[model samples]
Target: MFNIDKNKVKHANLFAAGLALGTVGLKVLTSKDAKKVYANVVAAGIRAKDSIMQTAEKVQASSGSILADAQEINEKRRQDEALFEEEESDEK
Candidate 1:
């Protein structure tokens, strides 16, 4: 007696149908309008990234200036303390 599995044949047919559908889907996805939309979306993303980078640069510059001012203030305080010590010692 010869025997064949019907279930395996059914699975193979379904797999082939899925592959065909997948090829058609790829063609639809790569159409002209789809490519333009993709390009615009990417350009917008780049612009957003550039804007964020500019803001970050500005913040970094401001922080650096603030740190410089703080250091200057600290130096002035040290100088004032030294002057006070000298004045006390002169009086004594």
Candidate 2:
């Protein structure tokens, strides 16, 4: 007479259930519908990236313009200061 442990039987049943669920999950993930969803997600991500890059380019261009304007203003200020100094020296 063979004695089967109840705990062993319960464990075996649980293992079988887990295996079945894993197989079904694999099948669903590999289905055509899932593939289409994945493709759409990737396409959307690419579009978002392009939009962000365009915005970044615009910002970079604007920053360069701002830096050039600042430099021009500083140069003008320096020239005015030099002229004022020359006038003061001529009077002394």
Candidate 3:
């Protein structure tokens, strides 16, 4: 037989608590009310995830348009600078 060590009293207490919780968890999980609550929580989580994804998609689409507009602005600026340099050369 294995001898009980007094030094592991804290570990023993935790183990007992874990076992008690496991038993209670089993009972709670088996109950119909707990199952309904768990199902609702899962559904809510899914809905929240879907909402977040939709917002992210909207942000992504707007950012793409903003980026395109910025590039267009930069292109126009470059072309205007080149035209101004050509005008200065003609003046000289």
Candidate 4:
């Protein structure tokens, strides 16, 4: 009679269990209910992306307006400073 190794038998059992689990997992993941869940997740992601894009557009528009106003204010300040300098030079 040949002697069997306990460690080899234990490893073989574990390997068989892992293979069975993998096959079942693959089937469950490819089932109809899983497909529906995936579709819903993708649809939700699309809606979220649309909402974020709209908010970003609004923020971009607001920033552009703010930048224009700031530039106008700086231009006015520069003109006023030039006028004051001209008046002081005339008085001298």
lDDT of 4 by residue, 1-92 (tens): 97999999999999999999999999999999999999999999999999999999999999999999999999999999999999999999
User: Hey, what RMSD does candidate 1 come out at?
Assistant: 2.4
Ranking by TM-score: 4, 2, 1, 3
Residue pairs of candidate 3 with colliding backbone atoms: none
Q: Which of 1 and 3 is ahead in lDDT?
A: 3
Local accuracy of candidate 1 as per-residue lDDT tens digits, 1-92: 85879999899999999999999899888999889999999999999999999999999999999999999999999999999999999999
lDDT of 3 by residue, 11-64 (tens): 999999999999999999989999899999999999999999999999999999
Our model 3 lands, by Cα RMSD against the true structure, at 4.0
**Candidate closest to the true structure, highest TM-score:** 4
- What is the Å distance of residue 69 in model 4 from its true position? 0.7
Model 2 TM-score (2 dp): 0.77
The CA lDDT at 92 in model 1 is: 100
Q: Rate the local accuracy (lDDT) of all candidates.
A: 0.97, 1.00, 0.97, 1.00
Residue pairs in candidate 4 whose N, alpha carbon or C atoms collide under 3 angstroms: none
